[model samples]
Target: MLDSIKEVLITQEALQERVAELGKQISADYKGEEVVLVCVLKGAVMFFADLARSIEGDVTLDFISCSSYGNSTQSSGVVRIMKDLDKPVEGKHVIVVEDIVDTGNTLHYLLENLKSRNAKSVRLVALLNKPDRRTVEVHVDYQGFVVPDYFVVGYGLDYAEQYRNLPYIGILKEEVYQSK
Candidate 1:
């Protein structure tokens, strides 16, 4: 609900423009190769759908779900794969799509997992990055926004499994989480 938001951080228009730009950049970078997009669900679902359409080349979609936060605002520092990719990424150029990267633990765990499976190349494309909260180093090939460290929701991000359908990204009211 809009009542739960304190402010809109990124407008829907801005998100669309940026995602288009990212698509062009990716299409250029991987010109002749068939790119396998590994969607890190379920937060990245909305972004992944938009991003996939913007891409200009042959793109195949796959999904992998790794969770560090269950119902909490912060991660437990333990990355567990709730779901795994159905197909092999062996010798394929893989790009992991994520909605946000906060502490980098989940991304790191995912990167290692994909690498071990013999992906020809593994890169990251995150819609949002909270660099202030990062405890480990992460290399994001494409990033939409470097947001201030806040509990954000919308455009695929969520708070307690809610707010993912909001058209724009927004900061959740502090009291909402504090009360919990």
Candidate 2:
């Protein structure tokens, strides 16, 4: 599948380093407090696993999967909750962990949903952010990389559910998705 990639945007080493750094910062910010990491599933799983190991203090992980895209390169602007968190986040310092924030629709919907649950606080931590595609204003408290408007895959990001197994993040060639 490397043949489908036009360029490598972030290497595996870089991604690991950044994630570790983010973990350190988050550990400092929430020191001595109970943290519930609500991981946005499927895509963010890889980052979530590594980050959880790096964190200090009391940390718990929950997963919620919301989808805005199917097999397309762009979001549909519609957010659907495929799976919800098993545990309630009420009265806890909750962090929404996402693989990428593109168009901001899904994340905004998720944040509002989580807030309505009576969580003491909610913040965002995204591995990648695409500001150019944002349709709504969303605050990302912590971020790994601000990527340009390119179709990226690998390291938990995917194209039609493929390329996610790749270790590094790379820009997918337009022709691959265009042919669909």
Candidate 3:
């Protein structure tokens, strides 16, 4: 699988260090509140697990799978809830954990949906952010890194459902996408 990768974008050690720092900040900010982490699934599998462990206080965990990409690199500009949250978010200090923030459509849709559900407070915590590609205004409270626009894979991110198992984050070669 490594053969497919052209170069590593973010090393595993670098990601871990950043995650630890984010955990510290979150743990400090949410010192005396009921923290509930809603992890966006598939892509957030690795990020959610790592962030949850790094947090010092008690935090409730939940999962939701939403998608705007359908077998392509570009989003369809429409977000769909593939799997809704298992529990209601009313009166909870909800934090939406995401693997990457790209077009911002999914996060915007999610925030609106959560607000409609009457969550006490809602904020975003994304491990990676692609600022150049944002098509909509979205708020990201806790961000690990702001990256340039690139087709990145690994650390739960994927290309055609492959490369999620990679320990580090890497940018796919142009040929990989062009050939597809």
Candidate 4:
């Protein structure tokens, strides 16, 4: 699996350190409020688990699966909700957790949908952000890293659903995606 990677973009240690710090910030920010952590499914599965464990305050968790990239590098430009949150967010401080923000379409759609449901306050927490590729502006309250617009995989990110198990984030070789 290591042989397929062109280079390691972020080490496992670095990811853990950043996540821990994010947890601290979140704990402090929502210290006296009712907090609901919404995990965007699949890609954020790993991040949500780690973040949830690290947070110190009272927090409730829910998950919703959303998709824009259906087995492709770029989004289809239309976001769809494959699964919806089990609980309502009305008058609750909500934090939307995501693995990565690329084009920002999914986040924008999610933000609007959450607002329509009357959430008290909505904030974004993304593990990775590729600002160069953004087509829509997104406000990320807690961003792990600002990355270059390279196709990256691992730490819950994937390519062809094959690289999510990798411990570190790495740049996928071009040939892997271009092969006939």
Candidate 5:
């Protein structure tokens, strides 16, 4: 799998340091408030776990799975909710944790859906942001890094379910997917 990587964009140490900083910022922002951290499943699992631990306040976790890409690098532009929150988010402060925001289609749909559910407030925290690819407007309250247009995988990001276990985020070689 290492052979298929073109370059490591973010080191493991960098990810850790940034996550810690984000945690501190979040803690301060929501001080004296209990927030629900909603993890956008599959891709943001590792980040969600690490971030939850770094937070220093009352926090509950929930998992939501949405799919726009299935074994493809590009999104089909159709968002599907594979899994919904186990508990109602009504009257709660909800934070959506995502691995990356590219086209913004999925997050836009999700934010609207969550808001309609009567959540007191719904905010977004994206580990990586790629504004160049956005097709819709989505506000990210907290962002860890701004990445260029590259097929990145690792630290919970994946390409066809591979490379999620990599310790750092890396650019996947084009040939690796082209050959598929």
Candidate 6:
């Protein structure tokens, strides 16, 4: 799997440091209030776990799975919810944790859905943001990194369910996907 990587975009140490900083900021922002982290499943699992551990305040977790890309690198422009939150978000402080935000389609849909549920507040925390690829307008309250428009995989991000276990985020080789 390492052979398929073109370059490491973010090192494991960098990810850890940034996650810690984000956690501190989040903890401060909420000021000890309990917050529910709504993790976007599959891709965000690793980030969600680290962030949850790093946070200092009372934190609860929930998982929601949405699919915009199946086995392809490009977004299909349609978002589908594979799983919904186990509990209601009404009158609760909800923070949506996502691995990456690319085209913004999925997050936009999710934010609207969550807002309609009457949550006290709904905010987004994305590990990586690719504004160059965004087609819809979505606000990210907390962001870890701004990545270039490259096909990135690793650190809980994947290409066809592979490379998620890699410790760092890496740009996948063009041939790896082209040949598929």
Residue runs of model 6 more than 4 Å from their true location after superposition: none
Give a tens-digit lDDT track for model 1, residues 14-90. 99999999999999999999999999999999999999999998899999998999989989999999999999999
User: Please, what are the lDDT tens digits per residue for candidate 6 over residues 120-151?
Assistant: 99999999999999999999999999999999
lDDT of 2 at 52: 90
Whose lDDT is greatest here? 5
Position 99, candidate 6: lDDT = 98
How do all models score by TM-score? 0.99, 0.98, 0.97, 0.97, 0.99, 0.98
Model 1 reaches what TM-score against the true structure?
A: 0.99
In model 2, how large is the Cα lDDT of residue 20?
A: 97
Alpha-carbon local distance difference test for all models: 0.95, 0.94, 0.92, 0.92, 0.96, 0.95
Cα TM-score of candidate 6: 0.98
The lDDT ranking, best first, is: 5, 1, 6, 2, 3, 4
Per-prediction CA RMSD (Å): 0.6, 0.7, 0.8, 1.0, 0.5, 0.6
Candidate 5 lDDT, 26-90, residue by residue in tens: 99999999999999999999999999999999999999999899898889999999999999999
Q: Which stretches of candidate 1 lie over 4 Å from their true place?
A: none
Residue 167 of model 3, lDDT score: 94
Expressed as tens digits, the lDDT of each residue in 1-180 for candidate 3 is 787798898999999999999999999999988799999989998999999999988799999999999779999998999999888889888999999999999999999999899899999999999999999989899999888898999999999899999999999887887788
Model 5 global lDDT (CA atoms, 0 to 1): 0.96
Candidate 4 lowest-lDDT run of ten? 171-180
Off by over 4 Å in 2: none
Q: Residue 15 error for model 6, in Å?
A: 0.1
Instruction: Compose the digit string of candidate 2's lDDT tens values, residues 36-132.
Output: 9999989999989988999999999999999989888878989999999999999999999899998999999999999999999999999999999
